[model samples]
Target: MAETHFGEWIAAHYATLWPELFDPALIGATVGFLAGLAPGGGSALEFGVGTGRIAIPLQDQGLEVYGMELSPAMAAHLDGTGVEVLVGDYATAHMTRTFDIVYLLRNTITNLVTQDEQVRAFENAAAHLRPGGCFVVENYIPRLRDRVFAETPEHLGVEEYDLATQIAVSRHRWIIDGEQREFSSPHRYVWPAELDLMARIAGLRLRERWSDWHRAPFTAASTDHVSVWAKPFSHSRAVPNS
Candidate 1:
């Protein structure tokens, strides 16, 4: 996390990535509501808030939104956008207040390379929320059955796997048609039940899970998921490392 090289790369290319990611016809509002931001009004805190792509639109819909971005390179675009951005490492961020909803989108949690770091982040997120707030995570399902290794931008594919630990990795390299050199990064992948355990340890519980932001049924064949974990008013607590 020294300088967030990958984030800089992404920020530099957002002109192209933004269209692919943010032009889903107000998908941000759709996801914000799913994260428990009421139609009336509520606050949202987004982790990995790259370039304010999702946040700016969510704010336009009337949600009081804030962002915690790990990369200044990516966050620079948020300037004068009216969104409160906190730039720092996501794992050990200094969140002074709580929000009604906390969300990590686009497999952002996987940026942490280890299980312990990922679990600690969940615990921190649980701690940084008001009672009854919800934690929403959108991530891909590990489908590394036949793809133990692959390349991207070069071949339009994704792949990675670590045996004996069940930790999958997303390996991608973007050597597009006219890019100078290749840009790549690998992110960890977590299973469905593993997320439940993380929620349980943080005194939260799974509330709603879907195959997509549209609330499609999560099935055996779904490639991704949007999972919600609620911090119940009656069960607010936290578990620390032993």
Candidate 2:
């Protein structure tokens, strides 16, 4: 797989192309609210924290949140929010602190071109988690076929419109590996099962899976998004010889 052609250009135009890009904070708040329901009520680490879309709000919700992002431009956007934003690639970056919950949301995992890199990302997350901590991930399940030419048209409201920008955002499906698939925006796709396998290989166990932030049941009709929660290795201390 080739590297994405537009990195710097995308970083520059991210805010303009996706006017609702900042809306992930709402999604993050929802996540924090749900995670708070769990025992221990832990802190969070957001991988690929673009422009504090999620991290800032998660922090505002009173969860101790830190961010690891690759783009300096995105990190700079989080300035003065008091959230710790580290500029580095999530695949290779290391953090001294571990969190009760680590998350990689917004279909950011697809940014990795190959399965190997994606698995490595899981390992990194596991390493950053304390024993019994959870790793939460939200991603779209790739369609088995491409529907890019299916011609199902949809429109956005005027608030989402940018006339001077000349940027028309539309949903389309494309065929990959003989599967009919839909991409809401331009992005690489991966199978949810494949992600689960990657998590297993990284010594993490899947505790729960959902179709959406609302915890909808996953089914065939669901192709939009999936949220997975994985736990680190169990911490059963060995007793010293009496």
Candidate 3:
């Protein structure tokens, strides 16, 4: 039997949710530049196009946006949104044509749950990108201060990292209006250098990286990064244009 999608619990409430949680408009506008979202612009593919929150807006900005969604319930929200959605794992989904830009936003890549799958996700993105196309990733940094556990509304606990494997396991818990939830999500928190290596392994090169959606410069103080990698114009050379 097929496994239920991770967001199934919140899928029904996704569209109307999170308005004040954060600003999607600003995020869309900022990502537009990387997606080539403009009048008669090139095409884009979003790996996890949940509820068309970002894809629809990007489509409105003139990019031909398509999506790969893993949840049927979440994909149902995309109906009549005009942005095409493919239902499957992005690591192995098939499409006839390539795109000008492919993006995985909002830390969705972590949902893959394993480093191998994460690397495969990059490979899939590389396969779907045209020469000179961009692959954009946005995810948070693992903030491992001395805190044993995070006590926000949503619960998250971090155990010590294993020295040999370099993997940090987090115990997560959530109680949404008394509907208790608990789970563990294993993450291979990737550094910028590691992401660059992944991109290189997938035949892409890092072009630009930013601290946030507002084009802020990335520094040690930054909590996350928005990075854009490009498919090389010449695979033999594997060099990016200046």
Candidate 4:
């Protein structure tokens, strides 16, 4: 069985620990962007929909929202939030009904920690979409070029990359409430070109790439990206775009 990096401690205190991500403006902006892509009354499926941060509000916007989460601890937070959840890995989980849009956000694809799993995640998203529907991914660009490590008064972290394996290991330490907390995880970092290739292998075509949810142009200097891919309406098994 697949396991989750986020566990009980992380789940119970997520909103309090990551207050920046829980900001109303940020959630509103993210939900607004996703809402625009989904037609009125359309359905959506969120891959790694931890705590329903975006799903609950998006559902409130009138779109039916479904979530796939690997952590039961995390899914517990969604109870009574009106967002239905499937407890399983997004990389291979299946839903009975397709959705108008499928999305993976916050660099969750990297959490797969292997190229094969990441590819399967893209395929899974395509499989869950209706014909001509869209799949969106929000991910941070690799910071290897800028620095290998980051440090602050409250937090410290370092990343080690293996170019040949396309894997990165990150170890982090934080001073929270005057105590020390630490975590380490391995991830596979993929470039934009590589992600596009994965989309093609999944029978999706690139629709747009932006620097942010606000639709700013993606540039070489940008630190993050939001990409959208569309499935062909003609056939479910159409030849992969060349």
Best of the candidates, TM-score? 4
Look at candidate 1 and tell me the lDDT of residue 161: 76
What is candidate 4's CA lDDT for residue 14?
77
TM-score of each: 0.86, 0.72, 0.82, 0.93
After superposition, the stretches of candidate 2 with alpha carbons farther than 4 Å from their true spots are 1-16, 20-29, 32-34, 37-41, 144-188, 233-242
State, as a TM-score between 0 and 1, how close model 1 is to the true structure.
0.86
Candidate achieving higher lDDT, 1 or 4: 4
Report the CA-based lDDT of candidate 2 relative to the real structure.
0.64
Q: Rank the candidates by lDDT, best first.
A: 4, 3, 1, 2
Task: Using lDDT, give the best candidate's number.
Answer: 4
lDDT of the candidates, in the order given: 0.73, 0.64, 0.74, 0.87
Candidate 4: residue 213 Cα off by (Å): 0.5
lDDT of 4 by residue, 115-187 (tens): 7888899899989999989999999898876544557776677787888888888787777889898877787
lDDT of 1 at 115: 79
Task: Kindly report which residue pairs in candidate 4 clash with one another.
Answer: none
**Ten-residue region with minimum lDDT total, candidate 2:** 152-161
Expressed as tens digits, the lDDT of each residue in 1-242 for candidate 1 is 42355566668787563344665754754555543445577788888888877777777877888888878888898999988899886667877899888888877887776777778778878877788888888888877776634443443344667766655555444455565444445566788788888888878788888988877899998888888888878753653222
lDDT of 4 at 37: 90
Identify the superior model by TM-score, candidate 2 or candidate 3.
3
